[model samples]
Target: MRPYNFSAGPAVLPESVLRTAQQDMLDYNGTGFSVMEMSHRSDMFHSILYHAEQDLRQLLAIPSNYKVLFLQGGASAHFTQIALNFANGFKRIDSVVTGNWSGIAHSQMGKLSDVKVHLAAHGGDLYHYNDLPPASQWDISPDSAFVHYVINETVHGLQYRDIPQLGKDAPPVICDMSSEILSRRINVADFGVIYAGAQKNVGPSGATIVIIREDLLGRCSERVPNVWNYQKHIEKDGMYNTPATYPIYMAGLVFRWLQTQGGVAQMEKINTLKAQTLYDAIDGSGGFYRNPIQPQARSYMNVIFTTGDKTLDERFIEQAAVRGLMFLRGYPVLGGMRASIYNAMPLAGVEALVAFMAGFQRRYG
Candidate 1:
């Protein structure tokens, strides 16, 4: 049997999606060529791409004014592309430096263009990564092009329970929702741009799904590369060049699977139960297994915990692997243990992890 995977991105996908892909591997739609070998410009591919976009829009309740573009380069590439597209005419871009991903975006924006990047509200040592500062602490510029934040940080186990409220005349809010998208319901109208690498909750690593407000298009500077221009991609129907065809098809299958499971609202409920089951295991351990993140800020998607003893942490990971749990090691920066429970991770997986933690604590604590 395949082990339960818990890696951060390029993470688990629904079993049903995998089975469908396997069945269609050789001949897709009675066509002689496999989906991997088919010409992207063919009518079959167009139908695949069209239905994928439509299903995603319906799943997310994406506004008619928004444009969904599936592209390459993942979320990291968009860090530079975002500045190129949105930061041209504006004087500054405000960013919240909460964790690794958002911090990376903030730093890259400063180097990518002429826009004066503002570190709106950085969490200091006292509250770093484990908690989010109050919205009142943000030093947002009224004239900035946009305010950026990550909805969830996979490494540090931090998540924003609600969208941060900006000032009355605050600039548009841009989010890098790489790890959290599709795991729950969200207001698509609340942000100017929502981008996520299609790895964790969506599909595989090749495609980056971007949903941008219509008004945000056509704002790319002339100096911006054609490949990175959002307006150009929109004009070309997300097919300006060869897209990540297989990954897009895979994402479409996953979207259809999510629809069968009652969409994101049902996903949110299952995700909550899965996260709470693991969190309860940690909390009930009586300081044996501890998660540093505050209760409210803890991420439902990525759970990071510690054994208080480094050797015990190491031993737990090693032993868990022997029993079939995989990739339970924490990120090097966090230095303990992490379990990334994306939408594809079922409650049974979380239950198994919790049971292993309990048994390990009994043996080692």
Candidate 2:
């Protein structure tokens, strides 16, 4: 049996996708060439890339006004790219500092360019994730090209629950949907840019999907490097640099699989149930286990909780691993145990996790 994998990113992929890749590893489409070995410019690879983009557009209901680009450098690169590529000579951009990812992203943008961030929750000591910082307090300017927020925070298991309707005058919104890309439906037209590191819910590492409004592509400062420029990326079809072909291909496969499963809306329903199962188990455990996030902001993908005792937390992780549940540990910044139930993690996996947690609590409570 394949052990249940619960690592945060480079996370679990659908078994169906994996098996298909393995079968096609040596020969792809009877072309006598492996997908990894095919030239990116070749029609074969072009077809692969084209289909992937189409499937993603269909899966997300991406508007025709958006340009989907498969690019390199993961989400980290986009952190810098967003500032340099979209700020249009404006020194500062808007940020909503929510959790670890958002913190790192906003901090980078601030250092590299003139960036302004309104901290949404400072470590969220009160309710794990209380309501986000009220929108009125943030400094907003029309010249500030865009606002940014991470849709789902992997480490803290916190989410916005709903996209913040920044004030009417607020700049366009940008989101890092790395950990929760396809787990729920999103209105693509509502945001200026949506980028995701295709590791968690999409496929493997190395690929990042960037969707930017068509008109917003050329607004970057002229000082921006060609490689990071949104205009260049869109013009070259995300091929301005050698792309992460395999990761993009796998992402395409995953998109197709998601479509087969009835796309984002259906996945959202399944994800809701999975998160509820695990959260309910923890909630009903009489304080044996606890999630820190506010109920309203709790993440549907990353479900993080604390055991209250350090030693006990260690015990639970070690014990959980022994039982074939792996990578339950949380991010280093936020310690405890975290269960990242991304798109590929089925309800069965969550059920197993919940049952084991209940059994462990009974013994250790």
Model 1, 15-106: lDDT tens digits are 98999999899989799678999889999999999999999999999989999999999999988789899888888998888888888888
Of the candidates shown, which would achieve the greatest lDDT relative to the real structure? 1
Question: Per-residue lDDT of 73-99 in model 2, one digit per residue for the tens?
Answer: 899888888877787666567777767
User: What local lDDT does model 1 show for residue 199?
Assistant: 96
In candidate 2, list every pair of residues with a backbone clash. Answer: 91-114, 92-114
TM-score of each: 0.98, 0.95
Worst 10 residues of 2 by lDDT: 119-128
On TM-score, the candidate that comes out on top is 1
TM-score of model 2 (CA atoms): 0.95
